[model samples]
Target chain A: MSLTYGAIGWNRQKKIYDLVLACGIVLYLSLFIGLGAWLNPGATVETLLIRGFGTCALLLLHIVLIIGPLCRIDARFLPLLYNRRHLGVTTFIMGLAHAGLAIFQFHALGDLNPFVSLLVSNTRFFSLPDFPFQQLGFGALVILFLMASTSHDFWLANLSAPVWKRLHMSVYAAYALLIAHVTLGVLQAETNPLLAAALGAGLASVISLHLVSGSREVRADSHSSLSSFDGAGEFVDVCSVDEIAEKRARIVTLAGERVAVFKYDGKISVLSNVCQHQNGPLGEGRIVDGCVTCPWHGFQYLPDSGASPPPFIERVPTFRVKVDGGRVLVNPRPLPPGTRVEPARIDANASG
Target chain B: MITFAKWKLAIFGIYLVIGAVFAVVFLAIGIARVDPAAKGSPIGFRLLIFPGVVALWPYLLSRWIGGEHAPRTERNSHRDGSGGADQ
Candidate 1:
């Protein structure tokens, strides 16, 4: 909510969040190294550092990826999403450490530039098991570096939320690259089936979580579309007024656009489901302080005009609505953004 | 050993030059565009984020120059407005 960013707007909550994160990382690393040393006395310090940091970064990436779908499934996970950029930046740093040690230990002694050696050392791209896995890891690291560098509100505001979001979505590509890098690199060298099975399990869990969340959203959308329109011209029967929980909304697709009809304060207001900032789902969010709050980042809009409150300028398209025979009906034609349409008042005498 | 050292030095030199160029650009844009509310941030905070600014200067510059001016009315009047559920 800052107009000018001097640095990060770290509050008490953020301070606590970061403190816990730092302590967790330290604990994880110490335990990992200690256990590895006890289990394999022959393992060198360089090997331990490489494996520990690499595994830690991979684990963090999985956590970061799951946070999105997890939040969609349950609102309790939103706290993790709030400070996800910090986790991403820490993951990048751990990955950088792993790359640094691996290059220094394996490629630095050769009579070639370590950077060049990383690119050309194993030019067996034609061979499945013998491919240059380091190059894939390097590519994924570059993407992570880009994401971490731009993980600030300054970039989000300047880049426009949509473009910023698209840029960050490149993490999925990076995740895929890293999976390949590990499968071809570490898994090939390590003869242990346990490590390979764990990696496979992690990948499957991530994929399954995404699939389940996606199916839930599809079901919601399909349910909205299943309601048949009244024979009345132009106006469609979305749902009964009672079907929408108070302060929440019933989202329906009309004229190829998703519109959220919110029931609040004994009145119903229809607005475009897409939020003006970051395109968050407005239907999923409840009304707070008489404004429709976006669940993603808490961007708010006046339900009637679909306009953000003063000092912040954002608006969403509004739709005309009418209530007849206890059924809420909406005109498919959307009004221009910021247009003030009268809300359809719910009748007190209507039966539930 | 000598050849390896030479290659390492050459790579280091190239990186230094690139870093210097980006640092200057970052300082210019970062000072101009940082949020006014962030004025309370300490000098140490600014220094901490300086490296990130340098790495992402190209993106910052593009966004600063190309601001989002199209109001919702102009864009969403006729267009189908659909926001992503996961975002």
Candidate 2:
């Protein structure tokens, strides 16, 4: 209670504090009296605990994914994001409880070993021949483990922002896994058509939003490429020395894709105009300390290499550029696919 | 004067939490007569079964709360940026 988060735009934090406190009280009451004592189908303490935790974990995953697009679609929904981590961690804890109790309930029935049951529990290794839905959640559980474990800034700092961002990008994969887990495991295993459809619909909403939103960025990239001056082959449009101010980037469209061409320290560098993460428009982002930092997700790209800083394996396509007679021109011809280029020499930089 | 969407979501959160907690608790205690009263109630029954009630709690809560969250703005960028990244 001693910690106080300072005011951030119209004292929003304080209101959230009050609201969350109220919610917490509600949670306490609901859990204590309404939640009642645990009941088991077979009616054992272990069984009840396991079921309770599993339910919590699945539900938490659903809620966590829902929050992001929710707030984006509506600013008022922003309150949910503040406490999203708590929800995710809570789910992990619930999942752990379920897994723990399950070990006792199913595997530890009489004389079976705990560790043996986990790995040996119906693991379907391939999707070609009947995918294992339970194993799918297990995979989700692994990503969640990494995400939840590394949620703090300590790990983030230790991993460096680039590495941390790369690690977190794995959540998209985790989301895909959970969808499979629910579709195959929950729907297939449980045979609950309504819940399955509902879960599917919910996931589809997110995916659809991403698809709808994502395609626009893609289209924008394509649009930029087609609309702008083409500098295919050797012709390039490197910005003039005077055109770029410090920390600002101008986007160039070549061959129907948007690429943010940055000028920093008298050097011209090109990076994909579309952010790989969430497709944040790179043109809108600015350079920070010689690195192009994405306003969204704080993803940083070395304008020179288009590769994320060390310990991070993410990359974006970079292009060659040249300034022609006071006009900036970029070569539409991309460097070889998967080419990771470091600082290319600019005439201005060479003169300097 | 609060917005209707906020009001709806709040109501949804309240009702969902109520419904989920009740349902989960009911499932945990209703079906089987197992009792773990080591603390206060009694120390009679000591069997275990997986109560499915808890898992559905969050989902129901999300449905209730998030379900009623009336889709507000219809802006194009809203679809892309979505407020999750703002804070």
Candidate 3:
């Protein structure tokens, strides 16, 4: 959350995250290459490096894909979501290294251009036994390159979040392509049942986690619709005031919108749950120093105004809220971003 | 065999040629005109976005020519309902 965009808004936490990431990459590559060399005495150094980086990138991609659903399931996983972009970029770099080595080893020695050789060398598209699996890997790499290049806030700001998000969502396509790449390329030759089982387990885990989190969200929406309506459906009875803890928020679905109703300092303020940065869930965050701090990146917004503090210009939409009979009834219609509304006062004596 | 490869190479070549030109022009003159925050940004910042600009030159060029000088607020379900947008 900077007024002026830099290459990277590095802080203590980001530095620590990158340092740990570097150490992990070094450790994993060292172990993989060492074990590969010990196991296969005939394998060359290039072969070991290609396999090591390829597997590392695939593992990182799995972790990246799982982080969102993990955070959705539990708030404690928010720290993993914080530096997830760094992990994504690193994954692309590792993939590039693997692709670079593979291309050099296989195609660079030919008379033709290496890329042309790569594309034309294998024309067995119809045959499963001899399919051109490198094409799938290449397609995935192109998608990853786009994502990694545009991972900065500059692209996010320019592309307007929704478009940026949609573009990044093509990661699922990349993941699919990579899965096919591995299945056709390596699994064809390897007689190892363990590798096949591990891939199946990873695929199952990704699918199950997404399904679980998505169903939970659908249930929340359904619960909101089934609950009581007030004031001719203008206001929805979201929850009781006591249901929201002090400095914390109770998120409710209202008219197809997720609204965060926060209780703080004997007052209640309702805001759109979407964070300005990365569309993180603001309802999952707690108020810090009188401002709603986003759990993902610590982007802060005033509970009343939905605006970030001075010198920072990020803002979310506020909602019209009222308290009746210890229950919080909120107008589903949102106000403009940064619009200030009087916080609904909470009576201490009222039984919620 | 070589024909399909040549076709792919031609497409790639054209995109890179245009992208190279667009990258130079955008970084030198067009970026600051489109984004105020990028007006006096450092070389590192320019270098950082270079790849993205090259890949998305057509879209960025449209925005630049269409006079969208400011960063657009994102439209969402809640914001659309309110006839507003979010940052």
Candidate 4:
């Protein structure tokens, strides 16, 4: 049907984020030359390629994991939710580079040899007694390769979020396999007890934090602190004007929910207590460099429009506020972004 | 993003262990072989975990950990429906 201006703004923001990522990728990859000189101590093209690709693969994994909770904790993360496929594809490219170097560094020789080192290197796959087991890591890496190759928007769009989600759910499977990859291959081939334990613990910790956070969120969903504001058509009584300082703000409970009302530059404004992003309380948050920041995700909003920063257009409705004779009155009338209203101006010169 | 506090210290501990393992293994291999240079592959190899671990971690974590909590309970979402919010 019809396209809203908010939609247009989101498209533009995506483009800006993409461009910045492109610049970063280029700059980061170019540093291989400097790294080769420092790390290898002698100039060799093979060493440079292998080390660079290895580092790239590691970094890509971090970026891929970062986007999800970021959005969950904050509503502003919705924009990135749509662009997640791009991130997947990027991670896949890094995996390809790592694999390419791996083949070249260890397995390449002049012939139609079929590159047997892939399955044959450690000899653990033969299942004979005293086998090294690193062969399992090789197989696991192959599975990782397949998963990486399919990471794309074409697949996600065609598969739908659930099927796509199910397929990507294999990441945990892939993670388990990668753990086998490290323990079976790197630990056995490398033969260092401390390193093996360290790698195992690292992956374990990441997984554990996820499990704990997931459990906490399960309980958190049933309750909303703002539920009291559930509209018996009753306004929450916070305090007298004497209690609120000049050019400042105070918070109160209305219904079961919280609301923040600010008297700034002698004008009154009201907004939801929680941030549209990470649920950061507007009451505890502050005006930083002129805009209100959520403290949790740094989401900023203007009191009047409740619109997010430029290049981003998500908006939260602003409610009506009135100061009647010395009493504060808040009507739960929320206007969509761009609505203009005249607010009563307090005398800047008056002390009380 | 990562909560970045506890996760980091754990990762650091992991790195130290892996590094020490590589160092010890390479040393042992060097000592065992009479001519280590001739028999052993000089190529230093470490673990290469596929890139997707980073990408998939957040989505899985949030899905399992964060759940689908309503973004903010501000306006009545179903204002058009009866008894939801006074328009």
Candidate 5:
């Protein structure tokens, strides 16, 4: 969405989002530290802070993980997906704070370097009772740091979306490692059934959300393939013009890629369903200001040219489309990105 | 805390040394060469990606040496399969 890079591309919405996020984080930390001190009078303030930051980070990470699938399940959750990188970066900072405090308390006073001590201070990896849980936490933190450092679009542009996506997808690995870090580290010491149950519940919820949304995607892809597919070199009959609400799109898979057939202003525009930003679902987006707006980050592309309006350079592929007998038919092949394709005009009487 | 093993210490030393050296070179010369957008980007932005560049120095070094730039090829299953634009 920006022509040049800066520290952040903050807008009014982002400023508000960050303000709310900061307040929530401050509120959570204060409450957690206060409650911890009240419950465990023997624990030091540093210990309470370490636990508070660690738990807060974990909770924020869960929210970060949940936002993606939640949006997929229901577009109503799209706003949460908008500023997710900010949440992710905040999560990493919290994790880093916790690690910093823990290292200073446990390892820094010794003769060995803190990181060196962290790695070698525990070699009980084979024993479940005395596992190197801190190391697991450290591993997870490294993954998180990598993700956090590269969270900006600068990296996304340089890394390319696919490579960037693959790197960020290691969040699952980090989550798994943290689960082990928690289960083996704290759960081993804290014999609270409540903690174990909570961890299990969190894991189950994440898994369940992914499964439900993933199956829905699979079903959609399968449906598109089965119902609309025609042989190559032929226009595939996708859906009736009426099936797509005005200013919205009906997604169809043609020749193995999804395209969004949009109906607006008595015409139809078919475009690749991939958002140039983050590969977000363009089909799920509505036309805003006469341009197809990506629901994820609000990146917009002209329906006709598949290019962002002037001064923004992002583009997506366009498709050849037409309407006959009120049925929308689209060529299975994608034109070059930013290629202009005249929209098929809808017959007012037939569409009615 | 435990006593450091010799090999572990050596490995850590090597990493820090290489990381320190690479950090200077990358911030000064490599990033703008590798990515045009990084050219004239703010100091904070360079600092932001510093840890990643340090950690990924070897891979990035390969890219830098090869004068490779990752074209923003919007690869999807459909695009790859269909020979779509910029594939």
Candidate 6:
């Protein structure tokens, strides 16, 4: 959103976000280590550190995985989404600390290189009790490290939003790896069914949240398909004008391309559902100041032209729209990006 | 046993070399893309993101070389149908 990238463009909200996150991490670690020591008086400091940080990182990762779905389910959770990358980076740091301490304690003094020992010391990859679980953890750590490093908006801009999103989606893979790592590594050694159950619960929670949010989105899309075509097929009927909320849109997929037909200011404007900036859902975003604001990053475009207002050069394809007998009809063919089309105005006396 | 140890050492050495090369390239890219709002020295930011740069260098390098600059609007396909579906 800025012309130039600064350290983080930290504002009051971000500072508060980081401070709260720091305090929470410190509190969690203190309680976890304190409780572990109280429970087992003979537990070593290294063991406490390893377990505390590992559990903290895993917990934070569950939060990270659920944030998107949580936001989708409720708009109130959007604030968490705003500073989610910080949470991710913090989780990676905690995971790294846990890994580093484990390596130092378990493998540093060995004759072989610690990493080599990690990789080759346990060759029982398929064996339940002796499997090389550290490798799975190491693989997950690598993925998390990649995600944390490129969590910046600079990377998002440069890599393109779709690519950046795809890269971040690899977190699911990392999650799977970590789950295997823990189930095989710690759960086996500890002989604790509670630990296994907790991990299973986390896995279930993440899956359920994603499923719920995904189903909601699919239902919305399905509703948009209830349309009839005109005799000429030149303009497809999307929905009735009354079906659209003011300043909102009805998104329709026509000929494989999605178009957002917006009802605003007693006029209808059709534009590509994709935002030029991050391919954010323009259809899902409400109009702000006569422009469609992208829900993801607040990037704006004039609905008529599908062009970002001056000084911002981004553009999305526009579609020709018309209102016929209270029905909104949009042409399947998209106009060249940045091409201006007059909006079809609703008469003052038009009925639903 | 000796041959096995030598193989392990060889693999470790190769990993170290690769790690060092990635670290160096990461440092280079970090300097170029240091956050403006970041406080403290550029080196600090570089160090912070060093691991990320190393792991994501291939993708970052493609972006660094102008490979990812195509506008998203131009690439939209009917199969994908743009935003809400993918998200």
Among the numbered candidates, top TM-score falls to: 3
Worst 10 residues of 5 chain A by lDDT: A225-234
lDDT of all predictions, in order shown?
0.78, 0.54, 0.90, 0.49, 0.86, 0.78
* Candidates' chain A TM-scores: 0.90, 0.51, 0.96, 0.50, 0.96, 0.89
The predicted structure with the larger DockQ, 2 or 5, is 5
- Using Cα atoms with residue i matched to residue i, what is each candidate's TM-score against the true structure? 0.83, 0.44, 0.96, 0.43, 0.93, 0.82
Error of 3 at A239 (Å): 1.5
Per-residue C-alpha lDDT of model 4 across residues B35-86, encoded as one tens digit per residue: 2122332222111111222333333234324443222223333121113332
| Model 5: per-residue Cα lDDT over A2-114, one tens digit each | 77678788899889989999999999999988888888899999998888889988999999999999999998998899999999999999999999999999999998777
Candidate closest to the true structure, highest lDDT? 3
Model 5: per-residue Cα lDDT over B1-87, one tens digit each:
244465776876788679768977987888888887677889887787777777777777887888986546667765664466631
Candidate 1's DockQ is: 0.20
Q: Is candidate 5 or candidate 6 better by lDDT?
A: 5
lDDT by residue (A1-352, candidate 1, tens digit) is 4344555767776788789889988899899899999999999989999989999999999999999899889978877876788999999999999999999999999887777677666778999989889989988998898788777765565555666788899999999999999999999999999999999999998999999999988887777763465686778888889899999998887766578999999899999888765666788788999999988777798999887888666677788887877888888777767677899988852554
> Which docking class does model 2 fall in?
incorrect
By TM-score, rank the candidates, best first: 3, 5, 1, 6, 2, 4
- Say which candidate scores most in DockQ: 3
DockQ of each: 0.20, 0.01, 0.64, 0.02, 0.49, 0.22
On the 0 to 100 scale, the lDDT of residue A318 in model 5 is 86
lDDT of 4 by residue, A138-172 (tens): 44445555465435322232233345557666666
lDDT per residue for candidate 2 within B1-87, as digits (tens), equals 224435655675686577556554533443222211111321111111111223234432343344332212111222222221211
Model 6, span A1-352: residue lDDT tens? 5544444657788899899999999999999999999988999989999999999999999999999899888877877877788999999999999999999999899797777677667788668888889989998998998798888765676556778889899999999999999988898878668888999999999999999999997886676663467888788888788898999988887655567889999999988887766566788788999999877667898989888888777777777878877888787767777778888777742555
Worst 10 residues of 6 chain A by lDDT: A1-10
C-alpha-based local distance difference test score of model 5: 0.86
Which residue pairs in candidate 6 collide? A5-B36, A6-B36, A6-B37, A7-B36, A7-B37, A7-B38, A8-B37, A256-B78
Candidate 3 wrongly placed segments (more than 4 Å)? A231-234, A348-352, B85-87
